[model samples]
Target: MTGRSQTEDLARLFAPYESLAATLLGRWDGSIAEGDGSHDRSHLMRVWQLVRRIARGEPAADMEVLVVATLFHDCVAVEKNSPQRAMASRLSADVARRLLDGIGWQPARIEAVAHAIEAHSFSAGIAPRSTEAAILRDADRLDALGALGIARVFYIAGRLGTQLYDPDDPMAERRPLDDRRFALDHFETKLFLLSAGLVTPTGQEIGRQRTALMRAFVEDFGEEIAMPEDLALAD
Candidate 1:
């Protein structure tokens, strides 16, 4: 058998982990509660779904590990639009270990999952280890694209209440954005950076399409702002 099939067979052994993972994810009351737009369960589920689809093409990827890692990746995200990248990475590793233990995953497998979760943070600056890790990383980044990303930006901005860009307002005086700065700045801050970091072929393709869509959206948004009379995508 090819290595891909072998990995698939191995994953079958972990078929019983879904419930355990869902239970653990339900406990993630971090940023979502306070309305931080960074990462939430809805976001987590979307990434989890994307990772699963990627694994279908690259069966060598471990579904169980990626599922668990993605679900728990941002369990400790910044508190409502803060830059808590380091803390999120650290907390995800700890939480992944605990959840994996409760599910009785092998010690080695648990450690691998923990390592992948901790290192998957973009700011953590660690390269991916397993295909599972790469998939998880790509999937996480994918969540920051297209319409979902737009909603996230405004949702976060509203919570933080940051203002839009201002040629006159001092840059240093701006608070971390809540809603206003999000529309103007998302293109540069996060959305524009995702396509390059995507790892899987399937993910990269989707990222490309989403990037095009987002760029168009941003350009049009700019026009709408310049005139405030031509709201094309308002519907």
Candidate 2:
């Protein structure tokens, strides 16, 4: 989707929290528009969808917190391969705290939002401490699975100029898995393992479904690339 369309969708999705959403969209729209395809507006919209879906089962979650957290979760864009990638969520939470505090949100609520934003990142290695945080984490990670996740893996690889896979050893039977150098290796490196780490039951169920799809894709991908004798297709 075009950035403008995605922004419009975000405006609608967060319509209940219009004032805060407007403030964020106005300030971050340019950055989001210029960001890599994997972390752009469409990705936010998808995460919002998952947040709502997961929240239904997690009735204790604070929607306002989810709303603001989703809006600023990736406010600070860092490339996946950057040394600073692990700090991206922390940096975004800091920005969210400043913005929400400026808007007069209560300290506790702002902290809730910030925590959700901070704990949502896979690279951050922080355990979620609240229902909102767990839901947001699961929601965001859900976007990194399934068909959408597959597309993002390659989209980011193209941005980094990485090969589709290491042609000599596509499955990395000898070489270590290096997603920075080969896109397909990312499945085993992270994507394939995401479902098992999901926090919410709802998110876990959906994650399992999506992960199955991704698994099938990788199996097919393997068959197409590997030599006949080397192939050991699953029964």
Candidate 3:
């Protein structure tokens, strides 16, 4: 899609919170010089959609905090394979703190938003300490579990020059699983495990549904590729 069209679409998505969207979008453009398909504005919008859905089940969550946190959760773009990947959430949280401070937000509220942004990351390993943080964390991760998750896996693998799977052992029946070398391995290494770790009940429920789809995709892939009968049986 054209850049203008994407911007217009995002504008419509965030129209309910114009002021916060304006500030967040401006900061986002300034932060990421080169955006990837997987973590661009579209990703933010999807996560926001999920956050809103999850928040409906969580009455105690602060909508404003979730909005701002969702917008800035990945303000700093870090490659998935980067050594600094784990610090991406912390860096994004710092940017969120500065932007909220500039807008004269209360320290406590800013901290709340910052905490949600900081803990939303999978690699960060920071537990969500509040309702908002937990909701944001669950929402962000939910985006990485389903159809979008499937698309993103291959997209990133192509970018990283990884294989679709091992030609001789697509399901890794005889070889060790390595996501860095094969895209399909990631389903086992991370995606399938996400649903069980989800913090919110809503997120967990959605994750289970999505992950089941992912598992079905993997099974179909194995069958289509005609995995050896013995190996398939072992799997």
What's each prediction's TM-score? 0.74, 0.90, 0.89
For model 1, the stretches where C-alpha displacement exceeds 4 angstroms are 1-17, 22-38, 80-83, 167-183, 227-235
lDDT of 3 by residue, 137-213 (tens): 99888888889999999999989899999887788889999999999999999999888889888998999899999
**Per-residue C-alpha lDDT of model 2 across residues 1-235, encoded as one tens digit per residue:** 2365556666676767766676666555235524577887678778888898999998788888998899888878888779999999999999888878777889999999999999999999999999999999999999999999999888888899999999878999999999889999999999999998898999999999999999999999988887666354431
lDDT of each: 0.66, 0.86, 0.85
Cα lDDT for residue 72, model 1?
Answer: 66
Q: Candidate 2 — what's its lDDT? A: 0.86
Best by lDDT: 2
**Regions more than 4 Å wrong, model 2:** 1-9, 24-30, 228-235
* Residue 42, model 2: Cα distance from true site in angstroms: 0.9
In model 3, the worst 10-residue window by lDDT is: 25-34
Where is the poorest 10-residue window by lDDT in model 2?
26-35
TM-score of 3: 0.89
Q: RMSD, each candidate, Å?
A: 8.9, 4.0, 3.5
